[model samples]
Each structure stands twice: as C-alpha cells, then as structure tokens.
Target chain A: MTSSAMQQLYQQIILDHAKSANGAVAELAALDADAATAASAAGVRLAQSHQVNTTCGDEITVRVGLSGTGADARIDEFAWRGAGCSISMASASVLNDTVRGTTVAESEAMLDLFREMLRSRGTIEPDEEVLGDAAAFAGVSKYPARVKCAMLPWVAFEAALLQLAEPA
Target chain B: MTFVAPPPAPARDPSDQTPSDHAQTDQPLTDRSGSDLTLSSDEVLRIRNDFPVLHQLVNGHPLAYLDSGATSQNPISVMEAEQEYYEQRNAAVHRGAHTLAFAATEVFEAARATVAAFVGAAENEIVWTSNATEGVNLVSYAFSNASLGLGGPAATRFRLGTGDEIVVTEMEHHSNLIPWQQLALRTGATLRFIPVRADGTLDMTAAGEILNPRTRLLAVTHASNVVGTINPIDDLVAMAHAVDALVFLDACQSAPHLALDLTALGVDFAVFSGHKMLGPTGIGVLYGKAELLAAMPPFLTGGSMITTVDMQGAEFLAPPQRFEAGTQRISQAIALASAVDYLSHTGMHRIRTREAELGRRLVEGVTAIPGVRLLGPGLGVERIGLAAVDVAGVHAHDVGQFLDEAGIAVRVGHHCAQPLHKKLGVTASTRASTYLYTTDDEVDRFLAVLAEVAPFFGVSR
Candidate 1:
C-alpha cells in the first residue's frame, strides 16, 4: 500500500479532539493530597499525566501522587491539553480515571497491562476495575504512534510514584 | 503513507549528439511560449520533453512530480554534458600540462563562464562551492574567522563584534539561519529576522526597524519553499544597504523558476543548489562580488586553492580558487552548466510565464474543492509556482498519505521553515509545487485527487 492509504486512519474522533482539547490544567494541591494518601498505605506514591500526542499534537496531562510510605499511588489529577485526534485524548482521559490509588508494585505491573491492552497485542482487556476511563483507548493500539498518546498518562502516573519513593 | 517508486528514467542511447553540439538549437529565444496556454499543445510538449525525468514512472505510476521546491528532474542534455566529458577527454583540469588537462581545463573554465553569464555576473564573481549550504556556511565561517582577527587587513569588512547585528528573514531554511546564529553567538553579535506577514509576505515595515546602523549583514530567501511567496528583495536590499550591511540571497527556491540576474539584484553574495535547478545533486553555485570575495579570506586551505607555499606559510589562489580548496564536484558542475543551458534554450522567461499560469490554475482548482484553504497569495504578483494548503480538519500527514495513494507527491510539515509555520498558525501544511515538467493534465489530476481527500478522511463535506 502507498503512504496515502495511511490517510484512512484520520477518523472524525481525532479531528474533534484536535479541534477542542481543553481541560489540560488540573488542581495540583488536591492531586498532591491524593498522592500523600496513597503513599501512606503503599511504599510509594504514583501519579500519571499525558503530555502530548506525537501524531497530531493532542496532549493530555495525568498526574499520579503517592501519599504515605511511597508504596502505592493515588490519582491526583488528570488534565488534557493541545489538539489532535480523538482516540488519543479519549484514551488518555479514560486511562487517567482507571489507575488512581494503585500500589507502586501494582502500578508498575499495571504499566505492562496498560501497554498490552492499548496495543491489543495481548488478548486481555484492561482490568475493568483499574482501567475505568482508559478503556476507550484499548482499540488505539491498532495505530502504533497513538499508543504513545495512550501511554503518556500512564507514564506520568509512574513518574509520580517514583518521585514518592525517593527519600525526602 | 505509501511511497510509490518514482518512474524509471528513460535509458539514453549514448549515440545521440552531445548537449554542447545542440546548445544553440533553441538560442535567440526569449520568454514567449510561441502559443497560448491551451493554444500551444506542441510547444508545451516540447518544453515537457526537455525534462528527462518526466518520461519515467515511480512504482508503475507515471511520476506526478510536485517536489520541484525540493529538487528538479534533470534534462538529458545535462546528463550528456557530464558524461561526454569523461568519455572524450577526462583529465585533472588546471593541474596538468598535457593536452588532455588543457582541454579539460578549457571546459571547466568555460562552464564557469556559462554560469557567470546566466546569473548576470562577471566570470570572476562566480565561486564554486559544494552546494548552497556550503556557500552559506562559507560566508558565515569567513566572518567568524575574521572576527577572531586572523584574516589580516581584508578581515576589517567582516569584523562583527559586540552590538553588531546579522539580519535574516524568518522564512530562511535552517541552512541560512543556523550558521548566522552560530556566527552571532561566536562574535557577540545579535541575530535578527524580518518577520513574515499574515499573507505570507515579508513584513518590510518590521524589517525597517530591524535594519539599523548596528546591522552588519542581511540574509534572506529569494522565494519561500512552503508558502511559495517571492520575497520583496529590493526593499530588503535597500534597507540593508542603508545600514552598510552586506546582503546575501538564498536563491535556492527562485533561481530555477525565475530569470535571475544577480548583478541586477545587487546582492553581495547569492547561493543556490544545482539539484533544485534540474541538475544533479552534490553541486551548487555561490556568486559573490569580485571585490568582496577577493577581500574575504579562504574558509578552507590546502590543495587546488593554494598559490606559492613556503615552509612557514602560503599564499592562496585568486578569489574563486581561494574559496574552492579541494577537488570540486567536477562532473556535477559540468552537468549543472548543461542544465543552465537547457533552461536557457527553453527560455527561462517562458518557463516562468507558464509556471505563473499554472500557479493561477492550481490556486483556482485547489480552492474550488470545498474545505481546502490555500495558504499564501492567491495571485501571481504575490505568489509563485507552488501552493500550500490545509484540508479542513484533516491532518497534513493524512493529506500526504491520501495524495501518495493516488500517485500524487507533495511535501508536508514545516518544510524546514518551522518559525514560518508557527507564524502561519499551522503545525504543518500540504504543499504542491510545480516546475517545467508539470502539465495542465497533471494539475487537473491533482485537483481531482485532492477532491477525494476530505471524503476519504471523512472530513465534513
């Protein structure tokens, strides 16, 4: 197939997300408190946010926080920014809602799960209990570049967890 | 996006007469096409056949070339000029005393004469460089060397130091921009730009403010690759001259498409790549005023460019030879001269006229398709033979992909003018450019293929 056939993938959902990618900023204080709470129960805190969708410039921010002993992470805030296709933003939005307040080890494990689920490389569905909002992005794995968009929030969540694990 | 193979270049039967033998076939010609747009089909075909690459296919598809802004297809005559040199009298020019060397040297110098004639400059003013990029870097690096106080008395003209300014346009390709930026950084000078207006024209009003007494040099593109806007160079040159600043022209986009006479333009230095002008890659021309080039120190030293050499030091060769230090792209240079001959034969004025007509047709056709917003000037006076457009709601990548599927090739993204792209309020754009080989049928087919873009992307009708 010629490079042009790749054009078929620019679905309407993508355009909508590109046209209106609001709600990028989030309340940092509230999300921070959630991180503190998650850390108390687990050894570390975790937060995730989507940065930018590389494909069409769509970006979402997901912040993960760990409250207690840095064992677990709690979803503090999920915000989106930029303009891009719908699948990426929708996927990030969904992923943010699903993985809040998970343990550090569990969050680490869930990263692979999320990646696999987003890619559809594995026959597993996202853990419904954990992947709540992120389920919309499960089909996004079909497009390789979009996977980065879907994974951005998750990566941010992991970063927040790592930050909590560091000695203050 | 899929990239179909570009058509295979037609095999040339070496028995054909060499280009030089037929160089005068279309001489005594001027800009007239000898027929109307639709009124002269034979004339158009004649012009088309002059470009050898157009006769081939890419991946079983006839090449629908729209990438002239990137590079143009060379004519057979250009190829023959390069090949015939090696086949007939191959020798190291100007370095050997034998007949072969003399003959080779004659052709080499004559090629320089041809180029000087083409650009409306004296033969002494034309300095051969690897390509336009090298030419820009040559000027930039020379300035840097001068700033270090190492170039002797000739260095005074380039002594840019603290509080000095080097002006460039925002529309410059990275090649023209970066070297100046680096030069400024090294010399404590300021790097400034003439801002682009909303209509894709240079903001001359802003340029007036930028070119003050502190300005030392001004570099600008003759034509924009992405938006296809020919710059207001007269105003820019005048502005820079007012401040005693030397002006450099990046003619990569304009030289092939327009009739350029560097002397008339009054720029201190002008640079263009051969590939973009229907010659082979790996060669370019840098034309500098004889006095200025003579004053500028050599950027590279050793080999062919040197004169009398002592154990402690060495004197350099004259102007052009001083700049071209190494063995040059001899064959490529020969081919480029031939390409110039081909353009001259077709009458650059006629080519430019035809392209202008096509630009008008392209603008009309592309605009008529709903949801396509053409960027830059809509008319010939402000625009050139290219069009950049945004298909409503569709990403540029997707647009390129769709076009590629239909055997149409166009450039996407910032086209290496990121600042201009940002100024235009677009992350990227889909650009369709044309040259001599572009035809009315190709334009019509392109428009037809583009009409399918919105529907294929499911963009709102």
Candidate 2:
C-alpha cells in the first residue's frame, strides 16, 4: 500500500491534471499567436516570463493576456509550457483553468491566497471554494524541498503579470 | 578478463607498507592467478562499524547510503582527529614562536606530507585550497594572471591570446568547465570540448582532431562525476604533450576511489576535495608539478604567503605557499590526514576490488529491470563503483522521492554535469555511488528499492 504521505502528495486529481497538461500546453501556444494578433487590433496586452528551478533544471514559461485598462482589466487568457515533476505541471494546469476568465484583481487575490497556503507548512487549512482544484496541492507544503516545485509556476505567473503592467 | 576473487586476507604485507606504496603498485590488481587484496563480505561489515553515520534508521528502514559521490560520511577516527586537534593542540600554523604554534605547524605540515604520499606526489607540490572548486579556480586565476604577464619570464608558456585554444570535455562538472569557459572569454581564446559518444564515453577521435598546436591547455575530469567512466588519462596526457599543451585533471571523483599517482600520470596539475575522500570539508588539495607551480603566479594575496612587503609592492613566496594565502584550514587538514591513514590501513587495492565487484552487481541488477536505462559504459566495461540511470516514464526527482521513502539515499539531478545530461537527451538522472565503507547488503537494498520505483509510479515497461 502506498503511504498516506505519498498519496496525499500525488493525489489522483493532480495526476489527472498533469496528464492533460500537454493538450493545455498546445492550446497555450495557439493562444500566444492569437494574443500577438489581438494586441494590435485591440488595446489588449500580452506578456511572458520564463523561470527555471536551478536545483533540478525544471523550467516554465508563463504567458498572461490582459484586456481593459488598470483595475478594471480582466485576465483574458492564461497559458504555460514547461516540463517538471507532477506538482509543478499540475500547478500550471490549475493556474490556467482557474484564472482564465477572472478579473486581474481576482486572479491576484487567488495567487496571494495560494502563496499563503504554500507557505503555511501544512498549518493553514485550504479553502476549497477559493482555490478550486489547486487545493489538492496543500499536501505539497509539508515538504520543504518540494515547495519550490509547487511555486515555480505561480512565480512565473507573477513575473508575467508584472510585465503586463509596463507602459509599452 | 576473468572473474578473479581476491584472497580473503588483507592485500599488503604489513612490513613493506608505506604511505606511497598504495598508489605505486604497477600490476593490474585484477589478475585472476595472482594474490590480490579483496575484502570479504564479513570484512566490509566490520568496516561499516567505523562510520557511525551508517548505523541509523530513516523512514523506519535501515539507512542505505549510496550517495558517496556527492560527499562521503566521515568515520569516527576522522571526526575525533579534528576534535582532538581543537582540544589539545590548536594554534595558527606557519606563524608565531610559541610551543603550541610549533606543534600545530608540525601537525599541519605532517598532514601535507601524508596527503602528498597518498597521491604519489612530493610534499612541496601540494597546495591547500578551500575545496576542489577553489582549487580549479586557483589554477585558472593563475593562468589569467600569467596571460597578463604577472608571473614574469617563466610564465610565458602559460599565456593565451586570440589564436590560442582551451579544450575540455562535455563530461566535466561545472567547476571544471565554467572556469575554463570564463578563462577563454577573458583571454579571447576559443573554447572547445571532446564530444560524448552514444554509449556515454569520450570520442577519442574528436579529441585527437581538436587538440591541435594552438591548444594551450587541456582540462578534463579524471573520472566523470555523473557517468562514472574513468578516462584514459595516460593517452590524453600524451596527446596533449605531443602538441606542447598543458593538462589539468579534475580528480575529485577518482582520488577517493582509485589508487591515484599524479606523478606517474604525468599530468601538469590535478585537484581533489577532502570531503569526498572520507575527510572533513573546507579543505582540498591542488597538486602541481614543481616547475609549473614555480612559474605560475599567485591567485590570492595576504599574510603568511609573502617574503617582504613594501609600501609600493610585495614580494611573494614560491609555489604552494604563494598560492595558499592567508590562514589555512588547519584542523581540517589534520583530519584529512587521518582519513588518508584510514584508507591506507584498509588498503586501496582491496577497496578498489570490492567496489568493482559491487559495481558489477549494481549495473547488472539495475539494467535487468525493464524501462531502466543505464547511463554509463555497458555491463562488463570497467567503471568506478557507481551507476546513473534514467527511468523511461519517471522524472528523477520522483524516483529520488520513492527511494528516499525506502531509506535509500542517492543523488538525483544532473550530478553537476549538465552538458553530459543534455548530450544524453535527459534532464536529470538517479546516481548511486559507493565508498570503501559501503557493503553488499547496501547495494542489494539500493537495487531492490530501485526495482520498486517504476511500478510504484505506475510506469509501464
């Protein structure tokens, strides 16, 4: 029998999400081109950030698309491409699914809550309504070495969002 | 080569034993008909008791330490050596006129002699550095200084310019590769590497073609930290010498396992870390031929390494002292000498034979499992007692986690040889390395745990 720790870390939902990440990555590539075309036609802005975990050489490039202006803006699209352990890939998949149609403020709020939970070291109980499928990652917070794996995608997401805030 | 099980007795005759005798044995110790020192299973079990760290449980299982390539566990004697130095005779070496200072200086210099003899080099030829990385950097910086005409007339041979070239191998750890890369960048010289073959060995054809007249220096690993394949140093050294180029060996992996004779190898320079050889950290050895070191400039400057200091300039000491500036890792050095003594007493020949047997067992067992790809030379090919493998459908980190839960500690990453991994078409791999203290049961446990990894991850054959 698999230990509870192993089962908790590699939950069935996380494995399912990771297996579907390839199709999501392909969709992200298609959206990259669409965002580039849409940016010129409308006032839409797109930005991408690439991050690498030096310890294991896992890498991710997160692309974020913003529509409308300032605080009223919403995340029109969210996508990523990378290869890593299940935690990192599943987190990227979850980020794409949860934040796509939400306002930029709502996405940022979710990101803040997610970061807090990861840093909680298994102390903070995750809110299922708030995190959606990402709540499955609460077990990852217990492993200090693997916390970075769960956070790599989110870190890349924040960098992409920062790029969207620039004047150009 | 036949399977020659060495005699049950310890290898060396106790009367003829000397520190340098371990590395100077010319006969291939594996000859089936001859008497060779090989540790029996019971002897290895006895040796395990020397290392206190090995007697522990992790995750409710007996700890199987197979990560000696990363850093070895210290024996009680090695730890006590350091502690004894601090307790009884702790003083700054090569300075002061007090009794403790004299005693400390004697102990420090004695350690140097012991380490030098272990590697078959003269006492004056070994220079102390913080670690192997720093040792490589020391030589690289000296070359940089020489390139700028810092060491004066004798250093001209070390100089490099636009037309000059530096050659390394794809299998080098970043410590060896990056320093040469930066050196080439700084001096406007071209940097090149000998490609790795499909079977994870060096392409000697490429090496011969690339090491031309313009090649000023050839830096390569004595044994690959990732692949565990020992290079043909004699052939490579001869090739480099034919073109009048200098050779530097990264001996971090080889020195601990092999009977290293730097003098016999005829390399211009070599470096090894203390921690990897059952010694303490914060101390490493850089072995340079006397003539080469005398010609090279100093890398660091401060107290205890100078002759005279004027307001305008400071005259420096020669060779080892010149490179070793400031206060040294005195206690660590004393402890490393103890480590050398420990290995010497156990006999390197016996250690090598036993490890070779374990290596064969590990390679055969790991390769037998479906979906597992061994990274280094194939079965029956000679390699250091280590194996790095990639699972078909699993990431290295996941495999590592699975093994850790079974109380088996192994290194899982690029093993600091990223270019080699990139060439092999893998992001990372799992490596299990053994030392003198590693036992048969440990190797068996590692193999058993590894077999379970794929099935646990639901990977198909």
Candidate 3:
C-alpha cells in the first residue's frame, strides 16, 4: 500500500500536536479540573461544552473563557480533555493553539473557515496564513467519516461560546 | 504543542509486510494452532474469487473484507437469483389469480421450503419479517396481544401477567434485548438477565439462579456478536424447558458461520437475518414450533394474513401467513434461498471446518500483539470466525483507520452491545470478523498492521 492517502490523514504535524499539548498546558490543566475549581481562574468568564461522537465513542469537553463583553469580547484561552483518535486529539490541540487570545468573532470565523474547508472535500483551498497548522486538516476532508473527528473540538468550542451566552 | 513539527517522513512502502515481529506469539499463540491452521491458502483464494467485491482494491491495496459479522457479501448465485426473479416473475405473492402471481407465489413458497429445510424446520413453521430485529418484535408483540387476551383461550398458554418473569443474557444484541424489555414493561412482567463472567463467557451458575419457574420466556443469542463466544444453548434450553419457560434463540451471528439446526437446538422459537448470511437485505426468518405459532395471536394483521374480514372483526390465517401481514419480501427471500443452496452445495460442515481454522488464526494473531488485547476467549477456546480487540492508549477508531488505510475493513466502536462493552471494561473495540472467504494472508497482514499502530502513534509497551 502507498501510504500517501494514509499519510495525508496522519501528517507528522498532526502526530506532533497530538502527542503534545505542550503549548496548551494551562488549558489542559483547566479542562482537567472541576468546572467550579476552574471557574476560579481570575476574572475570565468560563463556559464548558462536552461532546461525544456516538458512533466511535470519542468524547471531548472544551472550555472557553471570554474576558470582554458582547461584540468586543475576546476569547481569553481554550482548554479541553477527553479520549479519542489522533485526528480528534490533534484537532483539539491545533484549535486550542490557533484560537487563544483571539477575538470571539475572529475565533468563530476561523472555526467557520476550518469547517467550510473540511466540508469542501478539498475543493476550497486552505489558506495557510489563516488556518496555521490547521491547513493540514484540509486533506482530512477527503475522508467523510474522519471529518467529524476533526470537527469534534471545534464544535465543542462553538458550543462553549453559546453556553456562555445562556442566562446563567 | 509549542514546538513546530519536523518535516513529514517519506512514505514507507506499507507492502513491506513484516511477519508478527514481536515474540509475544512465543507464549503459545502460533504454536498452539496445530491442525486448525491447515486451511490451504489455495482453497481460500478460490473462495475469495467467488465474491466480486473481494477482488477490488481499496486505497491502493487488496481489500481484506473482514466485517462479515456485520453483513456477508452476496455471491454471484444469490445475485443471479434476485435478478432472475425481477426479470421473470416480479408479481406479488398470494395476491392476484394471474399466471405471474401463480408463478411468483409458487417460487416464493419454494424458497420458504428451502430455508425451512436448511434449519431442520417444517415449511409451515417459517415466518418472514424485515430483519432479525423485526423477528424479535413480532414474537414480543404476539405475546403482547396474548397478554391482552387477543387470541382468546388458546393464547392463554403464551400470556404473561404480574409477577411473571422474562430473562435474557447480558450478551444479547439490542434487537433481542429491547423488544423483551418493552414486552415486560407493557405486561408488568419483571425483566431479568443472566450476567457474563469477567472473561465474557456467560455465568451458567448465575443463569441457573435467574431462570426460575416464574420465567415465562428466556431469550438468548446462539453466539455473541461482540465476543464471538458460541454460547451453551442446549443446557440453557433444558433449564428453560424444565420450568416450562419458552425459549427464543437469536441465530443472527451463528446462522452464517456455523452449521445450525434450530430444531435440534430445541428452542421454541428463533430469529436470524438473511443479509448476515450470503443474501440480500430486507429479509429475515422467524422460526417457531407450529403448535406455538398456531396458538399465538398474530403480531401484524392485514390483507394477506386474514381468512375473512368484517367491519366488526377478522379471522386471521394460520401460522406463517398469520404473521406475514404485508406484501412479502419475495425476491429477497428467493435470493436468500439461493444463498442457502450455495452454502449447502459448498457444504456447511466444510464451511464450519474452514471457519474454525480462520477463527483460531484471528484469535491467535490478535492476542499475540503487545498492546492489542483480544476481547473474547483466549487461545485454544472455541469461538466463531471473529476477534474484537482493545488497543491500549489508542482508541479503537484509530486502530480502525490504521487498518482501513491498509485496505482492511473492520468494525469499530461499541458494536451495538454497550452493556457487554461495559462488562468488558472498555468503552469500545476494533473487531475483525472473518467468513468463508477470508484467508490466512489477510489475517496475518491485519496483525502486522495492528502492531504498527501503537508504535506509529508513539505509544510503546
């Protein structure tokens, strides 16, 4: 077997990010703690969303904290903890790195772009400047089944933001 | 990660297949299969060619179709039978008095007779349903009707009331589990289960305690889909019968791989899907003792099933037709009969012998890998041609992907038996299920690729 198609799904970059959430230790630590305990992270407004891919039993809980309010709000950081395949784990790490400290609007826009590129099935070219390490996932779009694994954390991030909007 | 990824490694020739490189097999996996390992590679290649789908390449590698436990591929003969039916006789069975209808009905009933003979049952004893799930629901609802006094004094023997009990095993697929659960819930009968041991085999000692005289029915699988354990059905049947409890054998997994004679098994009723064997989907069989079926109320009631009808009420027909209330799965049933003929011609004992060899190779090959943990019986134990394994630190989906990239199609996840997964202490597993067509080269390659998975992901023992 030529490992080209397989390698597309398991790029070295994905393997690197998947093995190490080194850049996102704070976020990982926050996700590991109880919500109430993690809530004590200064003045940041934190919200959490947990998602599971029922078919393969992959689970992820993403926590996004916003510092500013409404239209001007900024995503302070992101953290997550769960168990899944490398695509899912790497996607979570890459998403955490790409979206941290960006404006809430910008993060959501990036999420939309990543989602759109993945749904494009490699038709819409991924912009490296915009997607950063996430452009590697453009190849993931080829596999319709694995697309969900890549999107699991991004969906959780969106859910976390919407969860923050609720009348708590 | 804060650090940047290094350049991608040049693509390695995945075809440079390494033998089971690990010495874990020295622990008796490879050496133990003395005679079972004698399935000639030449014979397997011939069988593989019979399946057109098996000859194709998936992702640039030869396809090793190992998910037969999910659904077996149709052979050319089964396909021809279905196409012939559509080409020549496509009319509804038992409906119009036209020549086409007459021909279709005769052929359809002949198909019934073929399947009936296949399972050592009388032709009148087989009832058609959409699939095995529907088969379970049909009997459960028949009991529901009986409990409501729908079939009058005859169904009294089948009815359940307060304090009555329904029993199943912890290992049943949802098809068998849910219908009985709903039946118990509706009729106020208590639902109970016989649990499995830590090794995934049924605890027959516990089964003894759970199945008491109040047990009105005992539903169980002939073999477990998840663990591949060929259950001890005869002893269980005797236990259930000693107390006058009716038995429903789930033959979905066993029907295709094993030589099954449901009548000899002595279960009061049984269910198996046609698609799981070498046939088309949309057809399944429900076998019952003729007397039981005659006494029970029909689960579905409509045109073809009725003897006579009025505004007030209707008299249902007898046995098989009484249960088949809609337009029948005519072509599918006929194709299934052809599949049965194919299996019979090839010889079930021969198939069973071949599968036993493949089954051991699967168990041995899988268990010999370091981090890959085989789910069911270990080496030297009897199981069907399947093996489900849990890869430590690597999710089942990843194992599936790694195997998929190598052109090995397998089943991954909870496998619709979450309760059994819970008992096995894993959230999900990767299952490679073989059939009459699987070869040793495919089994060996699967093991080799599986060994690569943990190392590829930087997970080490």
Candidate 4:
C-alpha cells in the first residue's frame, strides 16, 4: 500500500540494526581484553565518538585521524562490532569499511547525501561506484522512522567530527 | 422509621459529622434500598468476599491487584443487577405497553436517574453508550453532525467550521485524542493540545494560547492515567467558559477516585466508564448539560429512540432516549447503578480518605527503595490513587516482571501515552494503582517484595 521508497526505509539496514547491531559490546566480548582496551583507548583520543541508538540500543563507535599534511582527516580504522538485527550490523560493518580511506570533507559530503537518500527528502541518486556497499542501503531511505536506525552510525560519525573540532 | 439508618447525605463529608456517621452502619443492610454510611472493616471485607474474581492466583502468587486504573473488580450486587433485568424486564425500553416492557423501561430510566444523581447531573441529561470511548465519540460525531445543521436549534450549539479550534491536553488517552482529530479533519476545524509541564502538570500558558476565541470545544482528562497527576480542571473549565467554548471532561480516571459534581463543575459534558468505577464493562455514561442535551443531534438512530415515524423521515425522542439507539446494554446499565450504590454505601469521602492514606504509604515505600524514581508530584497526597515510577537502569518490563513474581501486579510500557512517556524521558515506566478495596497490608507486602527483588535484579543504591 505504501511507496517502494517507504519499503526501502524498512530495508535490511534497519532490520539488521534491530537484529544485529555491528558495534555493540557483544563483538567487543569476542576480542581479547587487551585488544578491546587498546581500541577503546585509541578511540578516546579521537575527536569523534561512539553513539548508541536508544530506541533499539544499537551502537556505532567512530574514530577519525588527521594526516596533518592534508586539509581533511582520514578515517584511519573504522572497525565496529555489535549485537543487533542483521541489517544494522551489516550496514555498520560496511560503513566502517567504506569510510576508512575517505577524507573528512568527502565523508561529510557523503553523510549529507546518505541522509537525503534515506529520508527520500528529494531526488537523490547515489553513485554506485563511490557509494560501494553502502548503496545496498539505498532502498532503506524510504521508511521515515527506520531511516534513523540506518543513519545512526552516520550520525555518530558527524558527532565524532564535532568532537574533533573541540579536541574531546 | 424501622431500623432508622441515617439519610445518605450524597455530597456531605461524613468524617466531620458524627450523627450521620452512626446512621451509616446502624441500619441492617438486608434492605438493599437503605442508604447506609458506616461500613466497618469486617463488613467491607465480607462485601469483598462477594466478588469471586478477587480471590485468585495470578502467576503462581496471590493476585494483589494494583491496576484498577485499567479496570476495577465488580461486586455481586452490580453483577446481579444485569442478570435481574434480563430475567424479569429484558424487553426494549421507552416502547411497548406490555408489563415486562414497562418494567424494563422503568428500571432503565431509574438507572439513568441513579447515574445522574451520582454525578449530580439531571436524569434527562444522561446518555448511555457502549463504553467511555463511545461516549466521547458521540459528542464529537454529534458536533460534526450539528455543524452540518442536523438537529435544528440543538445543532447550533455544536456548529464548528473553518477557524474553530478543538482544545485538548497532551495527557489525553488515545480514545480522547483520535476522535477529536478525526472531527477536526472532517470539519475544517483545527485540533490543538495543551502541553505537559516538567512535572506532568498541564502547561497552563500553552493552554491559554490554545484556547482562544477560535476554540469551539475543550476536551481534557481529569487525571493522567500514566503519571497519576490530577489536573486543575476548575481553572480549565473557567478558562473555556470565558471564551464561550463548551467543555467536555474525560472522567475515566477521576470517576473511581474523586467525588464528581458535573453541574457544580459547570462543564457542558462529562464522560466516564462504568467498568472503571467498580461496575460491569460494556456500559458507559455521558452527562451533558440539560440545555445542550436538548439541543444536540442524536449520534445513533433506529428502534426505541423514535418519537413519530412517517414515510419521509422520523422525529427522535428527547435527550437520553434520542441518543440511545438499538437494544441498549440494559443489564450493564442497571449494574452500573448498583455499583454507584456500592460507592455510596462505602461513602466516597471515606473511600477518598482511605485511598489517599494508601497512596501515601505506597509512595513512601516505593521512594524508600533505592533506584526507584517517583514520576508524579505529591508522593501520596499530591495525586489520585495511582503511582508511577522509573526504576533506574532497569527496563520497565523487567521491573514489571520482578514485581509480578513478588505477587504485585503493575502496568508497564508507555501506558498508551507514548508521547507523554517520551517527553518524560522514558520509553516505559512501571505503575501501581490503588482503589477503595486496597489495604495497608497489601501495600506493605508490595514494598517488602520489591526490596527483596530489586537486589536480585542487580539494582544498586
């Protein structure tokens, strides 16, 4: 009864978020204690931080590193693991991989494009080659409420950027 | 006067009056018609024994009911009232000259009088509907019909068109909100709501802004079902009246706890449920001002509600009979009247006082327990007989489970006020409600069990 765009919002991205969150402590629990602590400590110095989806408790811990030689910082390591629905976990995993080599400015640009795509705010066509695996979530932008679940990680990434500016 | 019991002073507070106190229990209850006031603990306990559902094991424990806000346990007298009517006088009322039909009609009309006297509304102003939801919808539907000029002079009272606003509060139940929304959608009217303050009270400033000259009707709850906050309706009523806006009260929560005087309150319409007032379900009462009732169009039609029928069209009967269409909930209405009699026998003042005491105890006990955050104001005295709390770091569903295992029943989730809960910064909260039948021992047991379970659930100080 609803539009295909609406169907896309409830896509695998949100179902995955609810079913298998990719950055939760469950994944951390699988790692060696030393490695987990190392990752957490490494993240503490980064301007960006982790944020949890309160509605379903999915989380994403984002970290950004500036090369000092360039105007934009590189996403040095975008590793995440959590317990949630498959779509959320898969989306978080793919997001971490996709943003790793991308510059801070491009990431910001992509984040803008991603939000618009998810909301069906207007006509948005994601470049398949550039969007990579994140494009699998293109259909998910249709469900207004579910868009939050798909975009939770990206919002955390933005929050991380703000923190970078503040050095917290 | 044989076995002279005191005259039941329907509105008087008996605590300060000594002579009336003695007469309350002086007369033998054998005569059901006798208006008694002094119901002792033993007698009240015996009366409780008559309700079969009260004695039961829920979740492998003695069911300590703490959710009367959802619904009340009905007594035998009320239950039998329905059966008695069906057995003896089950025919359609306000029609037919047969003896059974006349008797049924008399009983039905008398039930209306009983409910009217209970809420201090005139008998002719009472309209029976399926439930409180229907009662509210009836008014909205009637207003929509009236705006279309259906009931002539009566229709003029409800005429709302473009620029007319329907005022409600954020704390309204969905039953109260959705109908007004649909009415607004149907009419070109605007639907506005008063926001809740930080402590769950109405944001009067927002209310003032919302209820201006454009406001045609104001519908709000007398109490919050989730937060347990008794709203300041007197000010709201006065404010609506200042702008000549008609006021309709959703008395679902208040009817069971506080004594209501609809006429004295000066509200145009008041709707409440029989089931919530310790009566049977499937019956609700709608009290409209006599003039307004005379003017409003009938919501439902067909059968006994007709005055004179012709080939072209039909003239409807007066006030209640006009509103009531098809076969009524005859037994349920009679039983609801009997429930009113029960409340009268207990004396509402005494019930109110006792529940306040119980509320205080419940709040104090819950507050003393670490990690329990009381949600509403006036810990015990500040609210009606309900209390809601957010147990720190624990999901409300978990808290509810822990309490259920302790033999204490509570309501969880957003309590059908999703937006209100979101505003209060919680997805859900646990609530325990009290009633006239609730005792001090039950409150103590609840506290003892909560303390024992909170620790087990890793809830720390």
Each candidate's DockQ: 0.19, 0.51, 0.49, 0.02
Ranking by DockQ: 2, 3, 1, 4
Off by over 4 Å in 2: A26-38, A166-168, B1-36
Off by over 4 Å in 1: A1-168, B1-33, B36-40, B50-52, B55-61, B86-90
- Each prediction's number of clashing residue pairs: 52, 0, 0, 29
Best-to-worst ranking by TM-score = 2, 3, 1, 4
lDDT measured at residue A72 in model 1 versus the true structure, 0 to 100: 37
Query: What lDDT does the true structure give each of the candidates?
Result: 0.73, 0.85, 0.85, 0.73
**Interface RMSD per candidate (angstroms):** 4.9, 1.7, 2.0, 15.3
Model 4, residue B225: what's the lDDT?
92
lDDT of 2 by residue, B1-461 (tens): 23232221123444653322322234342343234578776556656776878888988889999999999989776886788778767999988987788778888898899999999999989999999999899998888999998989989988988999999999999999999999999899999999999888999999999999999999999998877888999999999999999999999999899899999999999999999999999999999999999888898989989999999989999878998899999999988998998787667878778778888988998889899999988776778889999988788988888788778899998988899999999999999999887888888888887887777767775
Instruction: Summing lDDT over every window of 10 consecutive residues in candidate 1 chain B, give the lowest-scoring window.
Output: B2-11
Report the Cα lDDT for candidate 2. Answer: 0.85
CA lDDT of B255 in candidate 4?
Answer: 84
Q: On residues B338-419, what C-alpha lDDT tens digit does candidate 1 reach at each position? A: 8887777666777777788778888999889899988776765556688989888776766765676566788876677778
Q: By the TM-score metric, which is better: model 3 or model 4?
A: 3
Instruction: Look at candidate 2 and tell me the lDDT of residue B8.
Output: 19
TM-score of chain A of 2: 0.89
Among these predictions, the greatest lDDT belongs to 2
Candidate 2 lDDT over residue span A127-166, tens digit each: 9987989899898888878889889998998998887774
Docking class of 3: medium
**lDDT string, candidate 3, B1-461, tens digits:** 13232111111232434222111122322233343333355555655655778888987789989899999998766776888778877899988977788878877998999999999999999999999999999999999999998999999978998999999999989899999999999999999999998888999999999999999999999999999989999999999999999999999998887778988999999999999999999999999999999999988888799988999999989989999998899999998998887676556776777778778888888777888888978877788888899998788898899899999999999898989998999988999998877888888888888888887777875
